[model samples]
Target: MDRVRLLVLLTVFVDILGLGVVIPVLPFYVERFSNSPQAVTTLIAVYAAASFLSAPLIGVLSDKYGRRPALIGSILSTSLGWFIFASGKSLLVLYVGRIIDGLAAGNLPVAQAAITDTVKDEKERGQVLGYVGAIFGIGFIIGPAIGGALGHLSVTLPFWFVGALAAVNAVLAYFFLPETRKQQEAHTHPISLNPFSPMKRAIQQKDMCSNYLAWGMFGLAVASTQSVYALFLNVAFGWEEFMVGLLFMATGIVLAVNQVFAMRNFWLKKFTEPKLELWMTAAFAFGYVLIGVASFPLFIVGAILTTFGQSVLRVVMNSQMIAKSNPTRRGEVMGISASIVSLTAAIAPLFAGWLFDLRPSLPFFAAAVFLGIGFFILYSAQKTLPTTLDPRQPVVSEI
Candidate 1:
């Protein structure tokens, strides 16, 4: 890998690592202010809501101003958000922190755009993205462990640690990260501050619409499962908190291994992106159904299957979206994708919580159904979508 690609990867890794360190401990911190589990869940939604509102705007800014400035601003915002969260004296303060973090959540898309700017080859892009996915998985796995351990000292300690990490990362990036987007004359247009405008424009294209719908469904499924998975385990198997964390760690390890080693070394060689997506959808559907059955051994199997499926699918879909988009518009397109997923994530958890109250297994079944719908959408659009993984060919929109 070249220096630019490696720097982009490092930026993504550090950003995700900060997120990982905070998430596991967040709910516990929130409970100190409010006893309601719903309140904690609401905090998650608030962050997603802010991200949904700010993502497209961030993308537009990156396009107009340059990725380097946008990235630096985002990192600074994240550091500030974590600092506020750590120092919070009230629930309102916590909410404010989350909103700040969400509004600055452009790091992933900006980093991805930076990678696109650097790597021109489609296959090489996919491989590098697989590594990014692996970094994300590893960060999540290690982050929770760090948070859990730190919580023994103080619930807010992890937040403080992550805040410092983000601040340090921002300094490093400001010094080392160069502008990847070439300086060019700005295109004249009325820049819409409305967050939904970019998303609307992206989805108006026929091919992009199908892809977005499929991606949205997939996000919904994952969000719903995440909302209730720990509770489901406790209800069904009487597992304790440590067991739950262990399970998550195991799944993350599997996912990271699959993306970094399996996909990079084997899967990309054997299957096109579309075919890989189909197979992953099938795996997701099967895994969700198995999880709903609520047997211990089957649950383990389901965890492994779902983790592998979802991990590979995420990298594959991201690669496809980047490839299908016009090179110049990659940031805008990715921002739209991020915004839609955030919207779904904000909504899915509330719906899943309600369904879980109705039936412990309902959320799992619903996740399967969502994935099934996603599968059909992809299947129907297969002919219209690009058959090969190469981005150099005319994309589906051009057809």
Candidate 2:
């Protein structure tokens, strides 16, 4: 791997590592102030809401200014957010911390843009993106276990550790991570502060609307289940924090193995990105159904299946999006994608929390419905969606 890709991947790994550390323990941490599931989900929604508002602007900024600065700024913001969240004594403080982090949550998009800037080949780009997903899995594999151990000692310790890690990450990035955006391409477009403007423009583009909508629905499905996962495990199976963390670690293992091995060796070799995308949505739908069953073994199976499916599908879909979008506007398109996911995340948690209060399994069922709808959208629009496999064909160029 090249230096740019390595640095970008390292940055992404650390960012996700912090998130993985928090995922299993966040509910327990929030319970110190408020024990309600709604409170926990509400905190998640607040962050996603903030992210939805800022993602596009961050994208545009990276496009105009440079990815390195945007990446460094985002890392610093995340470190600050974690510090505040770790030190918070009240629920309001927690919300404020999350909002700060969310507002500058442009790390992944910028990192992706950096990779795209460096690597020009579409097929190789897909493989590199799989590596990104693999890193996420690897981070989760280690981070959750560490978080669980630290949380067992003190709930706040894990957060503090992640905050420190982010600080160090930022320093490393500042010294080592090189700017990847081309100078000629930089400063070509005027910056737009309105987050919704980019999103509206994305939807207005031909062959992108259905893709964006499908991605949004997929995000909603994942977010709904994820926001309530720890609570669901606790409620459904009387599992504690350690076990919940371990379960996530197991899922991460599944994700890592699938992305690294199954993707390069089996899936991509056998099927095209579009075909895998449609099929994976169906797999996700089925997995959610199995997860909704109030059985531990069934839930484990479902989790593994869904994790594998999602890890592959995410990479494939993103590869398709990058291929279809204009090369100069990759950052903007990636930001729009992030914003759509953020929007769904903002909405899904509230609905999931409500459904969880009604019935533990309802949220998973709702997730299945969302994936089913996404599957339908993709299936119906499959013919219209352009593929990058044919180098002779023109991709979507209109901004």
Candidate 3:
């Protein structure tokens, strides 16, 4: 791999590591202040809501300014948020911390833009994105194990450790990662604070709108289930933090193996990206149904299926989106994609949390329903996609 891609991958790794460390421990940590499962999911929703409002602006800035600064700023903000969450005594303080972090949670999108900025070929871009997903899986594999160990000692320790890692990541990014955006042709359009503007612009394009809708529903399925994963395990199977972490690690292993091996060797080689997208959706829907069943072995099978589906779907969708975007607006388009996911992240958790309180299986059932719908949308929209999956001419949109 080239220096830029390697550095971008490193940045993504650190970000995901911190996130992985927190996920298994968050519900237990929050229970100290509030016993409600809703509190835990709400905290996640707060962060996503803030990210939804700010990520687009951050992407615009990266397009105008450079990827390096946006990346560094986002990492630094994440560190601060972790620190605040670690020190907080009340749930409100935790919300404030997540809000701060979410407002600058543009690291993944900006990092992706940086990687794509270096590659011109659509096929090569898809391969590179698989590497990103692989790194994400690697982070998950290691982070949760460490987090479980740390949480066993003290719930706050994981946060502090992740915070410190984020801080160090910001420093590495600043000193080593070079700017990837071409300064000469940077967008000169006036910066817009309205986060929805990019979404609106994206939706105006017919093909892009179709993909975004599918992506949004996919986001809803993943986000809602993710928010309650640990809690569901605890409630249904009586798994503690350590057991939950191990489960997460197992799923991460599936994710990493698929991204690293299955993606290049099996899935991509066997199916076209469009076909993979549709098949993965079916895999997700069935997986969620199995997960909603009240059996431990069935749940494990479902988790594996969903994780595999998620890993492949994410890469193919991103590659397809990149092929459809104008070179000048790659950053903007990535930001819009992240924003759509974040919007779903913000909305899904609340509804899922409510459903979970009523019955642990309800959220998974809801997620399955969303995936079923997403599959139909993507299948219907296939006719509108480019016949060759090659990069198209820039679709001009209103600034």
Candidate 4:
């Protein structure tokens, strides 16, 4: 592996591993503050909302300044946020910590931008990003198990662990990850502070709006499913913690597999961005229906396919987000685009939780219906948007 890639990937791993440590314990921590399960969901919503608000700002800042400082600051912000979360005794402190973390949420997007800075070819971007994502996914797999095991000792332990890890990430990023943005080249453009400027372009241009809305709707389609899917599994099978962990690890497995091989071997080469998108539309429609009605074995199968299908689709969507944007405006464009998706993510879980309470199957079925509609929106956009491919390699047949 490339040394710089290793640095960036290791930094990401350390950062996410801390988050993993909290996965099994976060709900329990929130419960200590309130009797309502909605409280846990609300906490997550608060974080997502904060991220949605901060991403554009971070994007704008990165565009003016450079990636290194932005990344270093981002890590410090997360470190402090987690510290507050670990130390806090009340809901107010938790919310404050989440807001800080939201600001730092720019890390992933900005890092991707950084990767784009270093990665010259398009084909390599997918596989490289997949490796980046795989590291984070492995963190998710390893984090919870470690966190859950640690939580047996103290809920606060994992938070401190995450906070410390984030601090370590800051140091690693400082020493290791290079500033790849052509800063001297970037300095030629007039800097922007008006956060709405990026959105204004989308407003003025119909194609930009089309791409933005397609991504937004796709985000919304999956939102309710995440919040309710665990509940669905629980109601359907009375799954215990280990079983749920097993299910989560299953998603991670597919994610890892796709990152390592499928993305490069089949997905990226076979499907153009538009074609892969269309397949995603079809696969999700079928997958959700399967999730809604299938028995345990079938449910597992659907969930895996959903992961594979979405992973395939998202690889393209993210690359397109970068490729389509004016390079100067990339940070702002991606941040805001992510915000649209994050907005849905913020709302999806709450709705899913509520729907799950009413009927376990209801959320999956509802999401399936919405996904079908979302697919139509994507298809409409696909027809008009020319196939945008990576710059690195020859295009392959549609799988």
TM-score of each: 0.93, 0.97, 0.97, 0.90
RMSD of each: 2.2, 1.5, 1.4, 4.1
Cα-based lDDT for every prediction: 0.80, 0.87, 0.88, 0.72
List residue ranges in candidate 1 displaced over 4 A.
184-190, 239-241, 392-399
Per-residue lDDT tens digits of candidate 1, residues 342-394?
Answer: 88889888888778878888889999999999999989989765576555442
User: Which wins on TM-score, candidate 2 or candidate 4?
Assistant: 2
Q: Summarize candidate 3's per-residue lDDT along 1-399 as a digit string, tens digits.
A: 787889899999999998899889999999999998889889999999999988888888899998999999999999999999999999999999999999998999999888988876766777888989998899889989999999989989999999999999999998999999887648788877887777677768776777889999999999989999888988899999999999889888989999988888888878889898999999989999999996989988898889998999999998888888777778887888899899999999999999998999999999999999999998888876554466545444434
Q: lDDT tens string, model 2, 1-399? A: 888889999999999999899998999999999978999999999999999988878888888889999989989999999999999999999999999999998999888877877655756777788889999999999999999999999999999999999999999999999999888767576666777888777867877778888899999999999999889888899998999999889888988998788888888888888888899999998899999997878987888779978998889877777777765677787888888899999999998999999999999999999999999999998876554443213266556
lDDT top scorer: 3
Per-residue lDDT value at 12 in model 4:
73
lDDT of 4 at 115: 69
TM-score, candidate 4, is 0.90
- The residue-by-residue lDDT of candidate 4 on 42-142, one tens digit each, is 77778888777677767667767877788788888899998999898998999899888886678877777766666666677776777766765687678
Residue 144 lDDT in candidate 1: 69
Which model, 3 or 4, shows the larger lDDT?
3
The residue ranges of model 3 lying beyond 4 angstroms of the native Cα positions read 392-399
Ranking by lDDT: 3, 2, 1, 4
